[model samples]
Target: MNTQFVVGESSSSSPHLSCDVFLSFRGEDTRKTFTGHLYTQLCQVGVHTFIDDEELRKGDVISIELDKAIEQSRVSIVVLSKNYAFSSWCLDELVKILDCKQMLKQIVLPIFYDVDPSQVRKQTGSFGEALVKHKERSFGAERVEKWKAALTEAANLSGWHLRNVADGHESKFIKSIIKQVLQEVNQTPLDVAHYPIGLDSPIEDILLLMQSGCEHEVRMVGICGVGGIGKTTLAKAIYNRIFLQFGGCCCFLSDIRSKVEELGLVKLQEKLLHHILKTKDFEVDSVAEGVNLIKARLGSKKVLIVLDDVDHRSQLESLTRERSWFGSGSVIIITTRDEHLLYGLTTSEIYRAKLLNDNEAQQLFSCHAFSYFSPPQEYVELTQDIIKYSGGLPLALVTLGSHLQVRSVKEWRYEFKKLKAIPHGDIQKILKISFDGLDVNTQSVFLDIACAFHGCYEAEVIETLNACGFYSESAISTLVQRNLLQRDWPSLVMHHLVQEMGREIVRMESQDPGKRSRLFNPQEAIDVLQGHKGSENVQALVVERRALKGVKLTTKAFQKMINLRVLKIDNLYISGDVELLSKELRWLSWEGCPLKCIPSNFPVEKLVVLNMRESNIQEVGLDFQCCRSLKVLNLSDCKRLRSTPNFRGSRSLETLYLDNCSSLKKIHPSIGNLDSLITLSFSCCKKITDLPSSICQLKSLEFLDISSCSSLQTLPVDFGDMQSLRSLFA
Candidate 1:
């Protein structure tokens, strides 16, 4: 029996449905014969059905209890027997059922028993006679018209015609009706989320993918994103929306990551088989056996499966390894943080879940905190602050909103202040799961990014990190695949809270700043530096002048931080004796240096990036003669009197920027021997300049810019011989 059905907007939108089916029929006609047998079968199949078996006398209107039953039922089965319209109670019940069909979008299936569908729809024959008798008995003309309309609407619906099948056999007809009713009732919607904000667009997108020309083939779709970004929620919503279309052979294996740990793979495989096959009779002793059973039994049955929170590729291998294991038109959905786990799926089938936008985040937060779509007027700014802190991550918003609920504005202010200092623990716990899954080296790379290099370009960061003995390129790809890091073109982006969590992890390593791997707080770095509490464990530190007023640092501050790989300080005054700094330092950004040159004793040969955009340096000379590893040297806007350094030893330099260095003059002749130079820019130098005849010998230079160099004149005779140059701005 074909029992596939669709619920209208009203039905799907109604969250108050209490019963599966409501029977509307006349007690005098086929109630005991046809309707009673159908109700018995529905109960046998575990369908929650409502039948009016009471002996109450017929009246002009249905009882209030009956009224509620019709409104609460998800599907109302109306038995239009020969005498169904003869009773006023049956007509009243039919009228109420039809009302629910329009208002609540309830499923109303009318079974035409022992009567012509046209006769019932047109109010002819027994249906017409019953209506005429009701009018003659003064059942109210307006009420009679409502009954007529209800009968016509119900009869016109697509439902069972008893006489058209099984040659009018009552037993066969009742069995078919039960089967259809059971199928309709078994399609229960899964609970997706409490708020379910920003899910419609993703669900729509996935649905379109499923419907895009591959309907006849089994398709595997992957929903991948970082933890707490609503991948599982989206998968559940999509499952709820389309599971019924695959009949009852659908199973949502939730928390597959944890469930696999708690109950072995065999249990999960059993769940798949039991849910689809609809019986617990099947038993498998091992995963291999379960796989065989799943393939042998379900190969011909179309199914819909959602594997939520799948982390390991092995979990997928043991569950939905191949598409041909199920019947054609089947759809398998997998939600994971690691996009790489979905190996066999095509790009079109993999959906990377993104964080919510401002509007969506606000609505979701407001829903949880205020129990409304928006916050109150007095809390709008506070709400926006929370949303901004959430970084559009739905989990953060939900957690923050829920924590702030029922608190006063003053309490919210205090909580926000604390939150700025530290991420909420609930949010951290979930975000950390992705980080915790990474290998140690990848974890180190992620911590570096979160602690210091979040907004830095990927290429620049990679060069520095790679110089520090990290497998940067591969680790970055791993982090990106796991959704912990976002590759925003050249720059890498991380969620604000994830960065906070990483920083917090470093902080939690020890109470003393000297012991932490990274220090971003100015006061903490000052304490560690001035107190002689520095340690080799501190790998990165930043001290912005804006955060610390009139802070002075001695070169001795770096005496103990031998492992420091990244150092970024802005406008710090240093006037004490110089000490040897970290030999491992690779990236150094001192925006406003107060020195004539890098401290003479400082070790910088390992430095990959030396950015001194605006500094007091007098000249670029022999201080960097041994810095063969330098890849990028940014000395822009260094207005002090200067000349280009002799590039005898900085052959590894790939980019040299001298933009706005008005005092800069002369290109050192040795620059021709710097075979690895890829970019050289001196835009706006406005100083005495002439091309070195040997400049054209930079065979590896791909980009050369001399725009706005007022004093610059003449190109090399062999400038066109710089075949590797792709862009030249003169």
Candidate 2:
């Protein structure tokens, strides 16, 4: 076994190794002085040492107890102080301990305090004179000879010499002893995860891949996965299992990707060299120098190195780039989120880590939340719900479980309800690392999908995002590869935890709605509007649910939103003085709009999209002066009377939806002048309609849906100019 334990290495319950160390000191010589301090230091470091407490026990049963103590302890610490040989009780204990050491292969450490080892070995000074006093006592000569032999053997063995090393600092001396003994007692590798469910199978698979079978060959293995998927934990376990066998020169370099930015490559290279070379003062001025030193010095030594969470190829180049960097039989293992970093490496193997399975996730979560595998009888159903929401991600499961562990059931219900809207902060912090690594444009697209278009069709989301200038096609692919986003058939599906992280990014913009980039909370929105706190910072405002309490606002409510772009206000009823919607607005989706017309004076100069579906509108807005940028205008389900507006100058309009407009009457003569029009929908518009001669001018229209227009009479004669039209619904 290695001298130091890694995290998560639990001790086996063996009776023979029950006591960690047995303390043997002469009571009259050093019991109250050096030995007492040593025993206290051992206890502080969590060693199970058997120190003889003279104040607690009587002299009658002392010998029997001392014999049992030495028998159970795995290590015997014999403090050979001056006058140590004077007591028959001490000599008897020493003989028994030395016999156990030979028979059981137990560890023995002797401390020669203020006394020479030669004196103890030859029995010449204080020890020899004490043996003469023992000769006149009732003890037999055979017993005295046996005591002399035990002392000679122990003093000859290499051990701590206090007079030569301590320099009058007894505390420091005691601490040094504790350090060595602590390592011997707890030699675990790493604090393995709290619940290592489904851990053995993956580690076994990695072990198979790591097997090179020949001492002349070197092996490099990669463990790849998304963030919080337990890649680091698995890598540590693998390193702990086989690291001790690799000539005792091993280094576990963790957080390579995350820490390199804070602790530069030069520092990391220095650490790798120092750890594997077993030197403290090794120095290199630059990363290149460090790299050279590592290659030159460690080339002939068989080393084991675990490079954890490597995001870039440069980190590999500096640490362990090629198999020739180390001696034969050396092993190099790397854990990373990007598998591309190991693409062209020589003699490489990859292990793809996956999220925990359902059973494993439940077990892992139970360990964190309830201190057991499975919840209490009363919390069974609730714990299962928590597991389903976690989607088998171990980080999410453990984080959520820990958060709800000490809370009452009622509190759990309340917190779980809140999580449906905003995720747990600790969970978001971990998942956000993947999100934070994206570029600005990709991050914007992710936030859009997370906030509004999560369940929307992929095509529609792409079209809308393209119109808003967010390049999402490649960004979506990147997200999918990172396991942050997934695509369902019609709509995109993001893990609930990942989606919550995206929302959290927007939430962090500002607590006040006016200063936020996006506003979704109903109360915050109402407070912003009623208090006239709206600012130009807001880009999107979505009222997902109806107004809990009706809010009152004025015309100035939205006058400050100079940079507002998107609005999806389907719910909250904000009634008061009408405000001129911001001219910078691009996408306005106000379903069930209460107004008949959005007042012509409300300039929509930069509007790219507009939807007032299911409103009480009668006439189209007469403001064509500043609407040259309009791309989409949907008046669907507007029951009131309406007539199509004449388009003499608003040429940028692309999509026109008049579906379910029950009272539509006339088509203006210039209705066909929309040269940039792409989609035209007149479905369910059961009003009088006749083809305008100018309709054939829409050469760019791709989709034309005129189905259920019961009153339509004749088609345009020269419609052959509509060559770009792909689908027709009539």
Candidate 3:
């Protein structure tokens, strides 16, 4: 059943009208063919119809009763035929029908029966020749113009097109027409979100951007946002609000991203033309031909087109390439997850679909979960927890909220625990598509952040990962654009759910603690370390701040871990004759090393970053070894340090942080040759410092920090020789 007939059995929802349908057609044209069958179907279905079949004789005037019937009818069905306009009586009747439509605000449906609507609209073919005859008969030029205007107006309406739809089967066409009739008569509302929240602002913003100084100019607007952010809903709302008011063709092409594969681009193009032109079965065998056809046909008509869920720029290239493709006052709206997809589109602004705020999220979730605007007192706290995890994403909120509706509060608590452990499948499935779209290297970077580096500095993560042999420098921007990562002024931020999704992916690698690629949880790390059950597959690991008491690791604990690339274990308790770290290790951050110095056997050629911030272990190597690839080395707060390392082999070093190494220090004159260094920090090194004249030779250095050096210092006379310097902190 059509949604329109959801009320009383197939009747008009309005009770103020007298007759159900008023049929206006020519007796010789469609009285026995199309109109006759239509009337039979209407009457058989209990539709009270008032059709004036009384033919006036030659040169006889039409009775006033015919005019009365047109006035009393709720709907006027105008059937346009080849010879229908040849009769003066039919033209007079059409004029009266249109007048009643304006005065009574009646519903009007037009059926093009065996006649070209274009011929009727532009007064061109048989209809035009007949109108010329009417003029020759001196029916008055003004009266003839009125008849032509009425035909144009009626043909433009959304109604049946027989030649395009029903070439041979009239019965099938009649059924479709009746379905449309019922749909038109229906007063039922459309299907949309029950509680649409946080949409008014975006709608208002987009509409403002889409506005032109003149209504006669074609305008295009793009809505860019991530998945599950309600772009489609916003587009639908905007379409519903302005579609009918345009008095032209309106089309909303939805699910363009997922549907293109099945329906093909050519079919979508055909549908676009058919819906706007009020035709059916319009065929397009190729997208190229469809493009030409659309450009040729829709150029003169004002149209409202909303292309929803567009995932690629190619879709836009094929459908709406330019403003000139449509007539004046036309509007084209597109929605896509990638803002770059809308890159060169001719629009002033793009509206980004924002996540709901706290109150709105609560209310929306409540509607789906509790079937109302608020939750029960018992489940309020649990619902808040779920909302926090959802982070204002509409699809996640709705899905999780609805899933918890039938469960008890205790069950909600249990389900919340499960959601925290593993993300809701519905939410994760959609989010994973973004992850799955990336290449292997970018996916690795994303998982590294999710599992180990969520709160770390963005630069540090990028520099460290790039050192660890994962290309993260450009991938970060891609993740940010995809909405998986957000920039928080100085640091990077990942949604908690997205982070969990990455963690869950890592967990799926293996159920055993030692078999995973990375381990972040304290228990998992502890189990793997204490049991000496490490594996080569565990490439990265972080056992952060707190610990289960007394867990220890021997130096040989990492012997089996040949593939480890990153290790950041802070304040961990471990002591042993540590001889070897895997040769693959690139960045090592051990805050509290129980050993006196870094293991001599640790590979230096591959080591890119080494951080021992706030650690015990005074002396660095007397001479920096073959660490040719080292870009960053942070030993901030190494209180036992007495001297800087030799700069013999540290030429590639870019950033060297020695902040808060409060013990006495003496500079190595060899440090002056480090021309590749960009950032060199010596803040809070309270010990004495002397001049190294060669330091002035570092022309490539960009950042130099020497704050809080409480002891005396002498400046090199030629320090000003460094020309590439951007910032010098003294």
Candidate 4:
């Protein structure tokens, strides 16, 4: 009889064991039959198995080496043949394997080969006879009783039964056994995040989506969001939680964008197939061949695959092009910045990653910065500053928090100042990848919004951008799809860090603020205008109220800015000829202006928006006669204004707001010429007495507000002809 313990390969210099499975069986009964075949097939599939190959005389106790192997193994397989219970060594191995299963939570699988499961469980037939003979010998009663109990407990476990398979299908049975062994072996969890705060809810939400669909159908899920928004982290957490449920037929192909660039799709496909199949023998020569192989091999087995950081549609086409490529109940997850990449996927659900809320952001930040759940009392205010600046992005919070760890309060303040001027380098690099992939025109449009149009109404910004020779509609759509921009109701919103990155790009264009393409800093703009350092490179300029308290612009201040298309000034003093402003201007917002009137020579033909609310102007200027492209005109709270300007030349005007122009007296008859007017508000224009008949000719007018016009007497005779008016605040 061949009775020996077979030990798998273990590196002598290594400190830990590498064995995945330990085999426990009678060496003589099925040594060259079922047990031997099982061990060989397990080895062929790259499983590090421990099998007894050495032949020796029968002994009552198993060797120490054999016991240690069972303890170190991740799983133990017991091949129970007719005479398996006859060997004392096999019974001792069973007791040790069961002890490990309880103490170490090792997986135990009992294979009832050529024997009924009930025979093993009840210790009947050969099992009972062997134990009775051992008891009759010098073996202790306690040892015999322990062997019998281990057999009963192991046989009760959920395991394979050879008798259940077809009559001549032992090969199929072995294959099924190997598949289960692999499932238990590869159930190791992945490292999700250092501080996985706020991860539970998202994971639960994704799980619900997974279960909401029919169990027999494959589902593709896309997690889309801007960079640093935690798409990959959420995907990883979901993968870790459910990977074992798929029976270890799972693969997480991380950083797929980078992997594709470094090693072609064929290599990635090979890695994916090798991971799920548990073998490295399959070779893919090309992407097409790999696709066919994946569809053919994995089509029958349910799998979980996560494609992280996918950037292109082609990546999806090559990796998970069709739902039929995967089996029923299979789930394919993809995380990407561009949501459009998921549009072609069928039977899919898209989950947009949301920014962390205040509580979650605090907890996540505190974990990385202070190594606690919240910040210390001494740094509460500073911590809030960091959280606000992070704008709820998890990546920003984590990276910035880690950067500020172990630093003094003063250092933290200084670092925050630097961060405001420039986003974190790593974060910027990641976000810039999406920006860098855009076409030249779209990039310019993005820069425009990042510089001057953020928080502005989407329609107004689009009009202004269009006036500046951009295809604003398509560009804005592209930006939204890329996660670089978001439409919040009527306005467009960009992440604080993304805006900083875009502005930083403009800042790097030239060392001098005058030479840069856009100027957002009030001081920088004041300095450029005051020093007469203006240049054609300056395309947009914004100056806030506090910075313009004592500053005044001269006639030549904007003469050299020939390409300037956007200009926003707040409560500023202008002591020069406004006619010298750039003719290319498309957007002009001058709040608290002290001028009596806009000079007739001032350029307004190309202007799309003219907002001078709360200004000191006494009259609506005739210069508006050239504003054929103007879409929005807001002159609210200009208390000294008397009447509306003639609208003969402003045929494209869509929104006109003269609300709170207290001294306004009458509506000009030329208002009938505005065929495109949609909104007209003269609320609180208390001095106006009557409405001109031409006002009734506004066929496109949908909103009209004349509330608090206390002096008005009556409506126009043809007022009911304004059929388009939906909302009227009389």
lDDT of each: 0.83, 0.77, 0.77, 0.85
Better of 2 and 4 by TM-score: 4
Error of 3 at 405 (Å): 1.6
Predict model 2's lDDT versus the native: 0.77
C-alpha lDDT of residue 677 in model 2 = 88
What does candidate 1 score on TM? 0.82
Question: In candidate 3, what residue range of length 10 has the lowest lDDT sum?
Answer: 1-10
lDDT of 3 by residue, 1-730 (tens): 1111011111111223467678888888888888999989888876778777655423634567777777767678888888988877778878888886665556788888888788888988898899899999898999899989988988888778887786747898888877766544432223447677666677667667766446677877888776788888888777755553344377788989777888878878887887777667568889899889889999999888989888776788788888899998788988877776777765466787788899989998999999888789988888888889889999999999889887998898888888877788888887776788778998998998888778777877887788777789888887886777888866887877778778888888998979999988777888888788899899898877756445666657788888888887777767764446777877777877665666555566777778878878766762355787787888888888777777886678888888888884787778787878888888888885665788888878899888888784677899888898899777
Q: After aligning candidate 1 to the native by TM-score, how far in Å is the CA of 417 from where it should be? A: 0.8
Q: How accurate locally is residue 622 in candidate 4, as Cα lDDT from 0 to 100?
A: 61
Q: How many backbone clashes does candidate 3 have?
A: 1
* Tens-place lDDT digits, model 1, residues 187-275: 68777678878887777677766765546688888999988899888877777665545647889899988898899899999999888
Top candidate by lDDT: 4
Candidate 1 worst ten-residue window by lDDT: 1-10
Positional deviation of residue 629's Cα in model 2 after best superposition, in angstroms? 3.6
Q: Write candidate 4's Cα lDDT for 409-504 as tens digits.
A: 999989999888777888888788888889988999999999998999999999999989999999999999989999998999999988988988
Candidates sorted on TM-score, descending: 1, 4, 3, 2
Cα deviation of 553, candidate 4, in Å: 1.9
Give the poorly placed runs of model 3, Cα more than 4 Å off: 1-190, 212-214, 246-248, 468-471, 547-550, 577-579, 689-691
Please identify model 1 stretches exceeding 4 Å from their true place.
Answer: 1-18, 22-30, 33-47, 52-187, 623-625
